[model samples]
Structure formats: C-alpha cells, structure tokens
Target: MSAALPALTAPTGRRVRVLPGVYAPQHDTHLLLRALAREAIRPGADVIDLGTGSGLLAVAAARRGANVTAVDVARRAVLTARLNALIARRRVAVHRGDLAAPVPGRTYDLVISNPPYVPSPHGPPPRRGSARAWDAGPDGRAVVDRICEAAPSLLRAGGVLLMVHSGLCGTEKTLRRLAEHGLSATVSDVAHVPFGPVVLSRMSWLHGRDLLDRRADREELVVVRAEQR
Candidate 1:
C-alpha cells in the first residue's frame, strides 16, 4: 500500500494531493516550480514532466501557459497525475508508460524529472516494487542514466532539462552521465531534509562534495538542475 500523502495548495491557485508511498510530488514541487517559473520558457512551449508523480510539475507548466505532457510507468501515478490536472482545470496529456516510451514522435522544449534515486541493497523487495518509481540501481543512477540517454532525442534544439535527485547518489556521476549524453549540468539549488538513518547511511558518498551538508538529526534531500547540451 502507498503511504498517505498530504494535500498542498500551489500559489497558482492549484490544489495538489499526492498518493502515499508512491513518490509524492508535494515535497520538491515548490523548489522546482520556483526555478522553472523564472525561466524564459515561451508562452506556448512544449514541456514534458517525466515521472510525473501527482502531476505537480505538469500542472505547474500548464498553468504557466505551456503545453504540458506528463509520463510515468505506474498506472496509479498516471491516474493521479491526470486527476490532479483535471482538478486544477488544466489540459495536460498524461501517459501511462515508462520514461520516453509514451512520448514517442514528440519532442519538448523542456524536460523535467524528480525520479526515485535512492540506492538500496539487494535485500528484501519492496512490498510495492517499482523499478521506474525508484531503485536507481546499485549506484542509484539507473533511471537518471536512462533519462539522460533518451533526452537528447526528446528535447528540442536549445531545450532545457531539469531534474532533482540526491547528492548521495553520486551527483558527479549524474553530471558525467549527462555530459556523456550531451547535457551540461550545474547545481542551481539544494535542500536539506533529514531523511533519517537509512538516508544518512549513504552520507559517506557525499562527504567530499561542496554541495552537501548534514543536519544534526541526519536526513537530507537535494535538488539539482541540468540543461541539454
């Protein structure tokens, strides 16, 4: 069962509620939307919100006057996103399929994601296992890697790509992967949320980085922005 999620009201007069245990869009929606709304996106630019958990970004983009399409592999997420869009009274295309699969024959001026980026040991499987929702491989870059590889084809010339993951999951590795895929990345913003013990266990990976900081209680979260080369 998915965890219970809270309902949030966007400053744009939109109401959003993310389903529990299924990658709620409430957490990072504000940080991401703030950065995105400040960008030079044309009034009617095409946008894709990959991993559109609750369709937060998709709804945000639509409100910003862009043609937005949200894609996700989980049926529940897709349904939730579409419903959220409907409740917000925005016309967003919601696709139920893996990354980039349902978006074929179309390209976007901007692509964004807040994918599941926590690395996990090969132990007990999740009561709700969703490779597309989380489990970013041993290094926690699987989904990011795949997204980067496919982004160039999906992004238009000069299109921008924005993403949020974790500092523990090898931010540098993500930057390098983006480069390999012809994307250039820079840390536009970062947030610290005490994610508790399980999250702190991965802190060693972030120790030497300039961007990470540990809280007294120990949990943390990061938001990174990348652009297509």
Candidate 2:
C-alpha cells in the first residue's frame, strides 16, 4: 500500500484539516494574516482571531511575537489550532466556542477574522462546500454584526480590528455597524476573485435595485480596519 498523506498539515506551522466546506489551513486566512503582518505589529501584543477555522492567522500572529488567542466553534477546529500551534513551537490559546464568548477576562490589542459573510438563500441552508464557511445568515451580516458588536468590549482602547468578507452584504452596513460599536472603520482593500456560483443569487438582488450599474465584482472582497474609539 502507498504511504499515507501528511494529513493536510498546517501551512506556516499551523495546520488543520476538515473545515467543513473547504480543506484545512484556509487560504483567505493566510492572506488576511499576511496583510496584518505587513502592518506595524507590536511584540507581545495580545491578538485574537475569531472564527479561526484552521489556526492560520492565529499562528501567524504568534510567530510575529504577539501573544495570540484563536477561537472557533467547532471542536475539530479548536483541537486542530492547538495542535498546529504546538507543531509551530508557538504559544497560542485555542478555545472552542462561538464568536467572542469563549474568551473571558481579557482584551486584545488586535482582533482579526475571516468570518462567514455570504448571504444564503431563503430555503433550507446549504448542505456542503464553503457553505459552512460562507453562510453569514439571512443577509450575510449576522455573524459579522455580532463580531462588530462585541469588538469594543474585547479590544483595548485604540486596538485594531481587521476583517475580510465580500461586498454583497453592503460594505456601508459593515462600516456603519462598526461606528455604532464605537470603532472607526474604513475599507482598506478590495480584490476580484471567483466567489463561486452560489453567490449569483445575490447578483439578482443587486440588479433589481439598480445596483447593477456597478460591475459584478465577485472579487470585491472588503478588508475593514477598525480602531477602537
């Protein structure tokens, strides 16, 4: 018999297989952390990565000399993140819980996440593929809004928060929600990539509202940076 695969090891020292819809060590997570690392990340800064599916971003922050906490709702995700952290020889607290609830008695200097932000159809929820990773509930803002709502309490004054999601959820709504939560938010980046066919439904809604004047930017990923006020 042939030798077994390396079990989908973590990239950059953190790895986790089985993220429900996608394979482990998610790509967007790596990208998000890469962007954050490019900024001025302070040594020993406390950082938290919500929805840390594969521990990619959490490990990156730890490698950057920040004390990091990565949380996920799935038990598999939590265990995987912890294992990846160990393999990387980095210290990280991996918690199994939803959103910011797992973390208590602490605040972070940086909070980053790549949450489920895609709007799903009105019927029975998707049964597979990035569906678990992509579904953001109803209008796709459910989880995102919760994260924004909790950030002010979880972040230190002037702490930075970064998130990545698509434009279909109304980027302005995200910014407005951040402001409501006392965090100054702005669009930092947008990229064009295939959002998969499931997102086409959102296009119809946009088109109906005369929003079709703007191009179909499946790649229109938004990176919002918020500073706790």
Candidate 3:
C-alpha cells in the first residue's frame, strides 16, 4: 500500500490555463494526481492521459521525464491541453479524439484518467458543452465503462492504470470490470468531497434514483489502481 500524498491545490502550479468548456483541475483532479505521485515513473516511461482536459496530468507526467500523450474528445480541451503543455515547457503529444481512439495499436506504461462520472438525468453527455466533462449517462458509466473495457488494451504488461471517478458510478463495479478484463485492481485512494455544481444541480434526480440520500451533502471520490500482470 502507498502512503497518502498531500493534496495539491493546483496541477502544474498557476501556469496552466483552462479555456471555456474545458474542464479545470478540481478535487477529483487533485486526488488522481496524488495517486500518480505515489507511482515510480521511470525516465522515458510511456504515459497517456485519457480525457486530458487542461493537460495538467500530462504535463506533470512529462515533468517526471515520462513520454506523455494526452487525448480529449472536445476540441477546446485539446487546444487547452496543448497550450498548457507548451506553457509548462513539457513535451506532451496532445490529440483530439474519443478516449484512446487517437492512439490505436499503442500501449503505455502508465495510463491516467479523471473522466465524466456524474449521473445525469439529461440522457447522454452533451457533444459540445462544458457538461461533457461531468455529465455521463443516467447511471454515470457511459465513459467509465468504456475506460474499463479499453484499459486492458491500453496497458502493456506490468503497466498500471490510475483512474478516478465518483463513487456514484459504482466503485466495486469498476474493480470487478477491471478484474474481469484480467487486471488485478483495488481502490487505492478515496476522498469525501462536497458535491460540485454539476452534481448539486441534479441532487433531486440522484435522490430519486436512490444513488444518494436526501441528507447527503458530500460524495465519495475513489482512485482505482489496476495493473496488467
């Protein structure tokens, strides 16, 4: 087990700028970073950041001497991540595509993601809006489930995946899915955080779905670590 790392206030300091409609670094981002910090990333290790919004995690991995590639579905997010990587003077390959589609037939030593997991009553996530960062399908597994299925192919033997998502999306389900895919997985870290604006907006819907209690003021965020053996 890895010791807990201190919370980071901002990823890549204050240099990274988030454009409109791009997801900014928040508690979930920081939590994932903390998990990443515990890993031993050798120099020149291949790392990929899925859903790299502002490119914070990609930049951080580059700073650690890893060859980083970042992917995002939104054009603005792709641009934002590229700009942030440039500003950080880090060599990050930023691509605009869905999940790992931009890098086919490629595997990484480390894969990281803080994908959309908020259960939204709004059907699927918006194609062109800020809500794409958090508004997953009604069960909040739209992207999470995809990641679980893609993770096995994304990782090389001995490669590790560090993913963070809201407990609302089903932590055990993530672990089970990863295991079903032949990876040894566990919840590496967890944090209790107050509902963000997106979740707060759908509090009533969440309660109706029994995903949350009426008195619940916070949600559990979990970092799942899975390794391809």
Candidate 4:
C-alpha cells in the first residue's frame, strides 16, 4: 500500500502561471513537496529538481541547506523559476532542457520531480503553450519513463528519486520500471485528487482507453521514491 503525507501550505496551479507558459504549482506539486518534507536531507547534500516549474522544490531544498539545481524544458518556466528563487532569496541554479538531459556527468544525492503525466488522446506534447505543462503522450508515461531511465545515471550510489504522477498512468509501471533500472522503489505517498479541467475534458477518451473507470471522477496520485543502493 502507498503511504500518506500531510498537505503543505504553498500554492498550486498547473497552468496558473506568472509567465505565459510557465506552469504554476499544482496539487501534484504540493504532493511532491509534502513528500520531500518527510525526507531527512543531509546538510549540503546535492539536490536536483527536475521540471522545477516555479522553483518551489528547489527553493525548499535550498532552504534546507541542500545545494539545489532546477531544470525545466520550457524557457518561460526557467525564467519564472529563476524569478521565484530570486524573489524568495534562495540560491538555485536553473537550467533548461528536456527532462534530465541538461545536467550530464553530474549526480545528485536527491532528485525530485513533479512531471507531466496527464494521459492525452492527442499524439505528443504540445509544441507550445501552457498545455505543455500537463500533456503527456498516450498513456502519460512519456516524461515519467524518461525520468526513470535517467535516474540510474543522475543519482549517486545511495541517492534517492522522488517523483509524482497521476494514477491514470499506471503507478505499478513506475515502480517496476525503477526496479528494472536497479533502484529499490516503493510508493511513498498517495492522495486522491479530483480530475482537473484537462482530465475532465478528456473523460470520454480516458474511459475508452480504459485508463479511467466510467464512474470514477477522481484519480489517485502516487509518489514513488526510489533509492539506488
């Protein structure tokens, strides 16, 4: 069974952005942040926040005395996150690139992510716009799969990866993928959140694809924590 975490006080809104395309914090964001809170981060630990939308995770890590590097694929997200870090007075190194590609040859003690996992009937992620923040390709594992594939390389010998995604995208698949990549993984946190506008709009398609049940109006999100030993 997945564990539970306390809710946090920070803000959340996937498409609610200060910049045109930068995704604001959302429920999943808060979920991951709460999971990060439960971790006993060592002082000066190396930390990387993948898809650091508003630099919330990075700033939080920095506040905890961890050296933080935030990465995002969207330029606007990078700018907004940097602005957030600046305004918050937290020193965070922000980068722009797809998933984990930006930080090569560097390993982190803790890698955190709240990635795009909404299952889209459409082909691929959008070329632009706020939709880029939530639209994952069919089955919603596009970015999550990339993160799993990158975890073994990005994590130190005993480093940890904390990632959150919707239940519509197979939580078991995530756990198994991480294990296949040699990380001891488990569901560390879980919460049931109502379907957002995007998911609700795609309800018929979701049901047709068997990704969601007809009567289910809510989706369960799981936070998978994987540790390389």
Candidate 5:
C-alpha cells in the first residue's frame, strides 16, 4: 500500500459517462481510489472489482497493469462501466450480476469494493436505479456481510481485499468478520464526510433508529483492507 494518488476527485484525464440511475464517481469513490493507489500491484495481477459502479476502480487497477473484471448488479452500471473503460482506453471486463456472482471458479490476486453501505430504513437495496448503488438495509450490513463471507473463497492464499464503507454499519463487525475467515484485516483509511442527499433525506428515520445523533450531519467512511493468511 504505497503509491502516489491524484487528488480525491474524479480522474481528470479520462471522461466517465454517468448515465442516469447509475452512481456517479464521488468522494467515496475517490477515498477508495486513494486507498487502492497505495497497493503495489504487480503487472497483470488478477483483480476483481465488486459492485463496480462506473468501473472507476477497475479501470484504475487496469491502468496499473492488473487484469481487471468489473462486476455490478445494476444493468445501467454494467453498461456505464464498460463505456467508461472504453473511453479510458483501459482493459476491463464488465459483467452484470450480484457481487462476485458473475464470476465463479476463479480466485484473484486482489478484490476491491465500494459497496452500498448507507443505512437505509427501507427494506433492501433497490434492484434498479442509482439507489441500488448506496441504499443498503437497515443496518447497512447486508452487502458488507456478504463481502466478508465471500472474501476467503475469492482470494488466493496471499491475495488482498479492499472495501470501503460507512462506519455507521459497524467497523468492528467488519474487522471481526474478516478475521473470522482467518484473514488479517484493518481499517486502512478514513474520511469523515458530510451526508449526501440520500442520507439527508432519511434523517428522521436514521435518528429514530438511533443510528445517528440528532445533530450529526457527517459520517465516517473507512477502507477495510484484508489479506489472506
């Protein structure tokens, strides 16, 4: 984890096509990208980017010379990611499906995700639209839990997994979950960012659930890095 990163904004050189209903590259993406930049990926390292919204991370890894596959559940996301990769002139295989489900019978040198971790009072993540990119279940652990469960199977003996999510979902639980799988894990980086429109709209519900203080307007986003033992 030691490479220079550009500013915590969208990459300026390459244009990303943000289609409607797809999550656009934002602060959370930048935070995770910065964390990804730290890793010293060898040329052609096998990498899979789960929940690849616009293929930003996958393309970034490809730029670093890793073989990347970008996976997403939303159809729009899959298309947008592919287009973005094409625009960036990066080699990325874009697939449409749930996290890591589209690819089986393969282990990677690295796995990365910027999953849907917003604490939504809604029943589950939307099956379509931009909300699918961020509205996780009540505790926001729905997707996070799945990633933790899949880590062991998805990684090679010495492979790494890097995921970014909100602290509202329980950072300790994430670390514990990864450790339970016999992987060494830690919160590698954190950013206290202001709530976006989605969370801001659900303020009352989140406060009712005691997930946030009445006056709290910002939340901490953390990148959890884990390595196979």
Candidate 6:
C-alpha cells in the first residue's frame, strides 16, 4: 500500500479567510505548495502565481521574501487573495484578469498554478458560479493548455514553473507540450486521491473517455515542474 499523505495544512498556519465562490486550498493546492517548498526562492526573486485562487501560494511566495504577483479571473478570488495577503501580513500584488493577461511582457523567476483541470461533462467551463473553480471543458485541457502555451514566455531564462493538476488531464501530454515549447519538463510529484465531488459526479463520463477505470475510486494528481533554459 502507498503511504498516506500528510494532512493538508495552510501555508501560514493562521486562518485564511476565503470569500464565497473562491477556490479554497485543497489537495491540489497543498500539493503544489509541497512542490514550491522544494525550490530555492531567493529574497527578491520574482514569482507569479497564476489562477491564484485564495492566494495561498502567493502568500507562501511572499513569505519566502520573493516579490510575488497573483492573478485570477474571478473577482471573488481576487478579493479573497488580497484579503488573505493582508491577513498574513505579506505583500502580494494581486490582479484581476485571465492567466498572465495582467502582466504583459513580464517574466518571472518562478511561475506556479493549480488551474482548473477536472474534465467536465459540461461542454465548457461555466463563466459564473462555484463550478468555475474546477470545471474545464471536456478532456480538461482548456486552462492547462493555455498555461502550457504561455509558460515559456512567462518565465525568465533559467526560471521554473510548478503546476499541479489531475493526471486525468494527461500528464504526458503536458510534458510533451512544454518540451515542444522548449522547456525541459518532468513530473516531480504524484498523489493518488479519492475522487472528489466534482470527479465523482462525472465518473461515468470519465470512464467513457477511458480517463478513469471502471472500478477505480481514486485519481492521480501530478505536479509538473518545467524549467526554462
């Protein structure tokens, strides 16, 4: 049997206030944090947290003395991140916009995200509602693909990216896409987590797409780390 994963903990250990409709720090969030913890974040290093959700990753980056910027398309998420940063006594430049849109022509030493990767039976991700936090179009590449396409441009030379998503979205495809974009990428970590409500609700569809096993109750989450040479 695989070892049990550690309990999910907040980045600051203090209470993080999340606004309604914002994505809360969960398995994927903590998994990404674990990956981020392994990287060497120098004081004043530039970092960007795309799809920052509740700004947990941004706060962690700021706490490490990095100059951190966070972006999210959801207004509630943007507000939640700003509030959390304030509560953490950390300075995070939070922006409200699509991934990487707000920071034109800007590159960072580290880019991180836990974007929407759950394959949705719905035709596309909903523009409004709580579902936006996890729902992506069928095949689950809507947002992840965009990030892969933009990562190389978003990173400074020798920079790194750490993104976490469910393996159902095609881990190999992500690595290949990054490689095609000239980044050396690999799966740095993996975790088998039981299907959450979102995935459980679409089990039949996932099975139809061969993305899930008929008898399996868990799904794999992978942290893809890619470096810009």
Residue 190 CA displacement from its true place in model 3, Å:
0.6
Model 4, 99-163: lDDT tens digits are: 76777899999999988899998889887778878999999998899999999999999999999
List TM-score per model, in order.
0.81, 0.82, 0.94, 0.92, 0.93, 0.94
Q: After superposition, how far is residue 122 of candidate 2 from its true place, in Å?
A: 4.2
Question: Of models 1 and 3, which has the larger TM-score?
Answer: 3
Please provide, for model 2 over 1-229, each residue's C-alpha lDDT reduced to its tens digit, 9 standing for 90 to 100.
1133245654455334443444255445555765686667789999999988767778888888999988887676777677667767889999988777876868999999998877765533343444666776667787888888988998898898999887767789999999998889998776666656666757676566553335665446778888988
Which segments of candidate 6 are over 4 A away from where they belong?
1-12
lDDT of 6 by residue, 56-88 (tens): 999999999999999999998898888878878
Instruction: Put down candidate 1 lDDT per residue, 120-182, tens digits, no spaces.
Output: 554332435454465665566767778778887888778888887766577777778778888
TM-score computed on alpha carbons, candidate 1: 0.81
lDDT value for model 6: 0.89
Residue 114 error, candidate 4, Å: 0.8
lDDT of each: 0.72, 0.74, 0.90, 0.85, 0.87, 0.89
Once fitted onto the true fold, the runs of candidate 3 whose alpha carbons sit more than 4 angstroms away are: 1-12
TM-score quality measure for candidate 6: 0.94
Least well predicted 10-residue stretch by lDDT in candidate 3: 1-10
Pairs of residues at least 3 apart in sequence or in different chains that clash in candidate 3: none
Backbone atom clashes (below 3 Å) for every candidate: 5, 6, 0, 3, 2, 0
When 4 and 6 are scored with lDDT, the better candidate is 6
Clashing pairs in 6: none
